[model samples]
Target: MTTTAPAPAEAPASRVMAVPPAPAADAAAYFAARLAFHTDVADVHAALAAGAGDFAVVDSRSTGAWDQGRVPGAVHLPTAQIPRLARQFLDPAVPVVVYCWGPGCDGATRAALALARLGYRVKEMLGGIEYWIREGYAVETADGTRQLPPDPLTAPVGTDDCGC
Candidate 1:
């Protein structure tokens, strides 16, 4: 009797799964290139209060917004007027910190770029006036404004020399 081996079992077909490629390194490089300095609202307040050498704060929001409220001692230039008013408020050699409405706004970015182009050292306040008020920092109002004694959550511990 012929002993023929049974036909080999058929193998299931294999599939080639498609996967999305990761973003190129150059993409991240490009983004990093555009990014400049960033600082939190509290640090900015402390720096201003501490009298950081020759540093100035510039508000990049509109006049109406500026009138509503702003960081104490911040000069309002507005993003549109940065080219003309930058030199008036900011010295090219000194550092200027720019801020707009809030963290989600980019108005400060444009103002910072304008200042940097004009040869001024500049940085953006990460959280702007919104965070400043939220963090319990003193904000000057048109009518009148006053700051209560610094709270533990808002200001650092120790005496005024704490160097927050």
Candidate 2:
């Protein structure tokens, strides 16, 4: 026996429960929130290199993971340490950008929320350090600094950026 796809009109309504997309105004609001809450690795690298000290970059991984490698200038502020140690190391006035291992992890989100609750402005780096390294950005380690070629699956292999 063979099966074929249903015609759009013939498809059951229950099988096509798609909601209309957000209106322009709603979409605008959504994009604004997205821009406000997320920053990508490339932009973070540019901002750090330009010395835009308006925000602090923080790594929210454990000490052992941190010792493995980290964004060069990121502060080692593990999520568990935030309440007890945020004030001592972070300035509430400066906005913060936090990252953890990668997309598979929520440590960055938890850290961002914690810092926000402590009255610090915060944004979570979307791809975290994994994407940072995947995109061929340098990471600081106990041995010094290292960078790997961009994983083509994660970033354009060469020739300028992805042109986004």
Candidate 3:
């Protein structure tokens, strides 16, 4: 049997598209630092699963927000609480990956700063719990663990993975 595929959808509009490529050295340094400062949900999940990244995942939302949902095993270090309390839950030598509600929020960045000030290496999880749940990753709430179907717009809809 033969199957026909539908036409591809048009790309969405944006004010800024890809910029001209930078020089090789500049590009390399930028991306290397980008990786150093930021990670996405999938990579964080893989790293956590391997159990060897030597990084702590910190949820930098408020107590109410954390209680709403959070990455299982994530340290509940709210940004406001980090300066006074990060050392209580994090190792100085270990790196940290911090997240808040989603890309729309900057609480993770503030928390990262606080952790860094205290001398913990840090990276911010780019998409936060928003994309975690969007990509069907497990989250632990007071009630229990849960996940949702991946949104077709953000994730591959008909396959096990996007193969990216």
Candidate 4:
């Protein structure tokens, strides 16, 4: 007797691609707008390392967090103090990049919003100090500057570039 083959199983529906991608022009505009409002840890580091003084990097976390560890050379301006102290700490003419604790934190966004309302061109650093540390960048602490090995999962090892 000949045996019949089992039927093929159906592929699972993907939540990721469930909706088709936007048209190219729309996607381009969307991404351009996003980039206009955000910068990543690596990009910020590169710019700072290059001695580009065109913009300022602001740490929007609490004092404790700021003292714990922060992006090297970052200005310590917490979200609550932005309104009262931003102008004193940062120049209104220079653009600003704000970051908080990490990707999970919304402190940077708040800081950026406050700065924008005050007429400063601002962009939120996408990953904050946590990502800076994770990406093996040196952080300024009370003791001094320290750097950790890049997390293999988040960044490439033994390489200067993420190859993005």
TM-score of each: 0.67, 0.88, 0.84, 0.90
Candidate 1 clash total?
Answer: 0
Q: How many backbone clashes does candidate 3 have?
A: 0
The C-alpha RMSD of each candidate to the native structure, in angstroms, is: 9.0, 5.4, 9.9, 3.2
* Cα lDDT over the full model 1: 0.79
Clashes of each: 0, 0, 0, 0
lDDT of 1 by residue, 111-160 (tens): 98998888888889987887777666777878877455555665454554
Give the alpha carbon lDDT tens digit for every residue of 22-117 in model 4: 999999999999999999999999999999999999999999999999888889998999999999999999999999988898999999999999
Candidate 1: deviation at residue 120, Å? 1.0
* RMSD in angstroms between candidate 4 and the native structure over all alpha carbons: 3.2
Worst 10 residues of 1 by lDDT: 13-22
Across residues 18-102, which tens digit of lDDT does each residue of candidate 2 receive?
7767889999999999989999998898788888889999999999999989999889999999999999989889999999999
Q: Which prediction has more favorable lDDT, 2 or 3?
A: 2
Best by lDDT: 4
| For model 2, the run of ten residues with the poorest summed lDDT | 11-20
Show the lowest summed lDDT stretch of 10 residues, model 4. 11-20
Weakest 10 consecutive residues, lDDT, candidate 3?
A: 12-21
Model 3, range 26-114, lDDT digits (tens) per residue?
99999998999999988888777778567889999988988888998999998988988887898888899999999899889988898
Of the pair 1 and 4, which is ahead by lDDT? 4
